[model samples]
Target: MARIRANGVELEYETMGNPGDPAVLLIMGFAFQMTRWPEAFRRSLAEAGFHVIWFDNRDIGLSAEMGGLATYTLNDLAADAAGLLDALGIARAHIVGMSMGGMIAQLIALDHPRKVDKLVAMMTSSGAPNLPPPTQEALAALTAMPMQRTPEAIADIAVKAQHAIGSAPNLRNSAEVIRQNAIDDFRRSDRPFGVIRQFTAIQAQPRWHERLGSITRPTLVLHGADDPLVRPAAGEDIARRIPGARFKAFPGWGHDLADAMSETLANEITAFLKA
Candidate 1:
């Protein structure tokens, strides 16, 4: 709920746990707000003996929007996160990112090696052209636009998208909770153009898949075996390319960070960082 100027833009961020503890900076993906990171998930990391930080990336949530520009690169987004760390006086921290956030985390580690102690890339791809693309249903979910900007309209599209790419039916949040979260997100910010801009940036970024080997930080790649958006092989490819990186896949998991997976992901990430 606080704002700081970073990378030439104002970013909205929140911190949990003591500043004195080891820091864990979380970067969410695509058009997602930091709130999509899940409170319980962040609390679990905080309670597990680390300071947890989550923030809205530029042009999303309460953060400054850049609609004036036609497009920006992921490196720009990555620098925004790195600058946030500098603004906060955090010298080094465990960096974690999901989906597109994971790609940004890779850039941070590559571009600002001294600022990252450990790296966790979850449910993300390396932009490998040969890798399998998203399943038709998942692609539709990601590219679907709201018919109208009304809260109900936005929430409906969100619900459908979540259902399309989320974990198995039993592992995801209840339908009511999903709908409510969609509504809450719409109320927070209804800028569909911001999402299109982000997607454009992702597509426009130069391919950096070959640079993974240069990332010497201890790295972990986490993915859901059931993920139809970014298949499990994508995560595996990242692990394979990064010299000493570890890969872990969950059987019932998927592209979405459902409530059922939070505790498990917290434990897995905590153990890796602690190691």
Candidate 2:
């Protein structure tokens, strides 16, 4: 795990593929560490000839955590992402982000347009809180879970996560992967408060509809048809607001990456970036 002291924090990161290739940065969702981007996913991306970068956001995984909440807006997170690229001496790169990471990526594409060659927003929204929130069961399942060490608790949480995603029954099963991921998360970092701080920045963000037109970068919006946390409407809204943005939705994929639908997601991204 290489570490870079950047963006006012020492970020822990990992890189894949040839350093000489053009890059794509993979930004993960809330409470997820840098490693949350599955190695297979990275390998698939690297195989596509893009140097993929994955890193822990501040207070995640091996990154430095000053405890207490950060006085940061979502825009601050975007700046931090740009700072990461600067630290790595990257002038421009494709940006792919999921959930909270997607939000940050959107801001980056909007704020530092020249730095982004292409943008992929997955399972995320554009601070458009007017859309319906997750269903009551999904909201309770997602927002109520605690990050802890107990196997039973983690198992239960995984079950809830599975239910919330509402994966199609015919799809490849992801139960084991999801459970293993939760276990890894518990072992890696348990700073649930970090998620709270990040949510603080996310929830307080104003709608970006008026500003979406400024994103001239080619953009792709990927959403889970069955996703409860972030509805497909969010993706539709983003795609509609951003001129020329392409949107794709997959059945049986929820917010979680455990879905077997990742190949489809990766393929779409590869095609988009190559275009």
lDDT scores in order: 0.92, 0.81
TM-score of model number 2: 0.93
Q: Whole-model lDDT, candidate 2?
A: 0.81
Candidate 1 similarity to native, TM-score: 0.98
Per-residue CA lDDT of candidate 2, range 1-275, in tens? 79987778788888999989999998888767877776767888899999999898876688777579466677877887888899999999999999889988999998888779999999989777588788887777767664655865776687666666656655534667677777777777776777777767777776676799889999999988988888999889999989999999988777777546657778889989998
Model 2 scores worst on lDDT over the 10 consecutive residues at 165-174
Clashing pairs in 1: none
Candidate 1 steric clashes? 0
lDDT of 1: 0.92
- Which regions of candidate 2 deviate over 4 angstroms? 147-151
* True-structure RMSD for candidate 1: 0.8
